[model samples]
Target: MRRSIAVCTLALVTAVGCGKTEPTTPAAPASGSTSAAKPMHPAAATAMQFLQASAAGDLSKATGLLTPVAVEQLNKQGMTIAPLNVESPKFIMTRFLVTEENEAAVEFAMQFQIEGEQQEFHGCCVMKNIGADWRLAGVIIDPGNGMEPVVQNYEQELSPPTTNPANTVANPAGGQVPQTAQSPDVPQQR
Candidate 1:
């Protein structure tokens, strides 16, 4: 009887032990998944949002993401940004440099198709942490196509000077006939 009781007790202990549950952590969501809308970094999220907004032709949304200085610079340059027809925009976060506790530079690569043309651009976005939010301070894009921002070439000749009769200065000779044409201004040396 004692042996049976001991066996039952062992069985109960084994059953209880077998029925015990172990703690588990949920798996992390895949990157870029909407259901898990968490981004790897704040600047990355901002950049991606800006690109998406621009691609969707949401100028208001896109401009809203830019810093005040960026908007002013764009305005100063008279830039007319056409809506991009981007497909499958991918953002790859690269090196991130923290200049200070509140400022950081995020480098990233963007790949997408614009008007059916495949395009890739590398750029950096300077971000400033503002009261628990990350704001884009500036953006620099390098298309890596040996192209640069269009600049007015002041060295290039504009146009031939227009002949303005009203602005023309009077001849210093003051209506005097040229020496070759008539008598010299001063007596010619014999």
Candidate 2:
């Protein structure tokens, strides 16, 4: 009983730890700024808004600007993909540079917990102008963590890759149980 209690406590702590929120600089001003408020560009503003929504797991707001195909794909995988994130991102404004194009690109960094795993997602996203709002076109999820191709951060090193784990069941006792979606409770990792 004590073992089980310890495990459950650990699991909950891990989950809560990963879900902690971080701050991010959405944009930077080009010239002498009066206030701390960043100047807004319709295109860049649209792009940043979409990213913020996505990062917060508020997919509905983000998808309001998505192309049809993207929406459809997400819906089809809705069971497995929770559009909500486990945590918020902390972005460095100095690195938040925007490109000049109908296609908008912003490079930034963020770290958070999702499903008990703490991860830092840093990359660039390309946006296409869809009427007034910006739509996601392409994303580069890998910037590489100065180590190997797959080795980006320590948190990743600690977790196992999401390949098919041989049949492992969850114990009501859950220390480092490493619960993947394949658990009997979670119905759609496949």
Candidate 3:
């Protein structure tokens, strides 16, 4: 079941979105507020509900919050009905990484005890905003490997100023640009 969860998580990260959606930048959290002063966004709350239901061994409730695709992913990973064996789970934080009109990405951190040892899982989930409802489209969690899940970097991927090496101009400074072909804009040395 643990392996299935991890595998499903990996799959969901890359499989979240199917339609092109404009990204909405979340407001910066107020200084000194660990979880921010604002109420959780609906999409993020949906993800939290899913995690809570899973932790509490309520598979039906958890699945109810997931999109059809997410449920299919769980079924494919052999997690259709199995609930996570987590105890004393507590959400540490939740932040919206990408919030669009029809989709939102939520980054979350939670601590729980499993097999009598405390463990922390931190990752992101993408939620689809349906009419008057939010459903989890995908989820990706870090399984204690000490590396953050890549979903946390979605903002950078969607941000402007996307750089392509071929289009890059040589630095005016002494630093050499790493490229096989010189930029067309730069004068070729004789």
TM-score of each: 0.48, 0.45, 0.53
Model 3 RMSD in Å is 13.4
lDDT of each: 0.51, 0.45, 0.59
Better of 1 and 2 by lDDT: 1
List of clashing residue pairs for candidate 1: none
lDDT of 1 by residue, 10-88 (tens): 3323322222212222222222335444335665566566656766788888777766555665566656344656655
Model 1 CA deviation exceeding 4 Å by range: 1-38, 68-82, 114-118, 149-190
Better of 1 and 2 by TM-score: 1
Error of 1 at 81 (Å): 5.8
How do the candidates rank by TM-score, highest first? 3, 1, 2
The ten-residue window of minimal lDDT in model 2 covers 148-157
How do the residues 1-190 of candidate 3 rate in per-residue lDDT, one tens digit apiece?
A: 3332343344444554333323333433221123553466677667777777777788899788877666666666555535667666776434564434577666666777767888777666767877899887656676657564443222112223434534445442236655557788889999
What lDDT score is found at residue 146 in candidate 2?
Answer: 50
Q: For model 3, which pairs clash?
A: none
